[model samples]
Target: MSSRWLRPEVYPLFAATGVAVGICGFSLIRNITGNPEVRVTKENRAAGVLDNHAEGEKYKENFLRKYVRNKHPEIMPGINKFFTDPKY
Candidate 1:
């Protein structure tokens, strides 16, 4: 009777449903707490400021940040040089 509910074939369906529920729950929690990507302060409430600090935090956590930080010379050295280099 109870064993009927514990079939091997149902495990994948259960796992997938769990994952979907988890994603939905996470999104609901984030929506309730306010998205970190959007900066809403007294001054920027109406227009919503560009949250560079949050963006930087996100970048710092990225998988590439660890390798890129040590290997890359600059964030965009060529473009920076093109703009900053004196034109004579």
Candidate 2:
């Protein structure tokens, strides 16, 4: 039964079929995800990236510190100690 799969004539058909299926799967994935091109103009795109950082910096602390303080206040003492204490 195993040898049947390896027969000379049969192998090419299976190999060709597998190659076709793999190519189709690759194209299907690419099509479903998105086109590869970044069509937006360069100056506007660069401006957007810088703008996002500027917006985030408007806060007193970076977003992560603010998140931990609000949601995980119990950890704040340990966090402050880690930053301020001289001992490693």
Candidate 3:
């Protein structure tokens, strides 16, 4: 209202310029960038997932077994709350 150059009506022009600059900059960068390569290929996917899962489960069981042997000394591994119903 008071300043001529800093009028509220010029705010939209500044916003539009900012958005245009952002889009132009993004487009320029993307145009120069290469497509990402997959470090793990399809051949490794299934086996890697299965192996990791089995290893993780083995670690969990071993850790829990050790803890039970030291602390509880009575409770079995399969009898815990973590075990689901066989039907599922």
Tell me, by TM-score, which candidate is best: 1
lDDT of 2 by residue, 11-86 (tens): 7899999999999998777544433232255665565434354434444364567767756455477888788899
In the range 1-88, model 3's lDDT, one tens digit per residue, is 4597898899999999999999999766644442122124556444543435554555456544866666744356456534755643
Q: Tally clashing residue pairs in candidate 2.
A: 0
Candidate 2, poorest ten consecutive residues by summed lDDT: 30-39
Off by over 4 Å in 2: 35-88
lDDT, residue 83, candidate 3: 70
Q: Give the candidate order by descending lDDT.
A: 1, 2, 3
**Best-fitting candidate, measured by lDDT?**
1
Candidate 1 stretches greater than 4 Å from native: 36-88
lDDT at 22, model 1: 100
Residue clash pairs of candidate 1: none
lDDT of each: 0.71, 0.63, 0.59
lDDT by residue for model 1 (18-75), tens: 9999999987775545655544465556665565687557644656666676665777
Q: Which ten residues in a row have the lowest lDDT in candidate 3?
A: 30-39
Score every model by TM-score: 0.41, 0.35, 0.35
Q: Model 3, stretches more than 4 Å misplaced?
A: 35-88
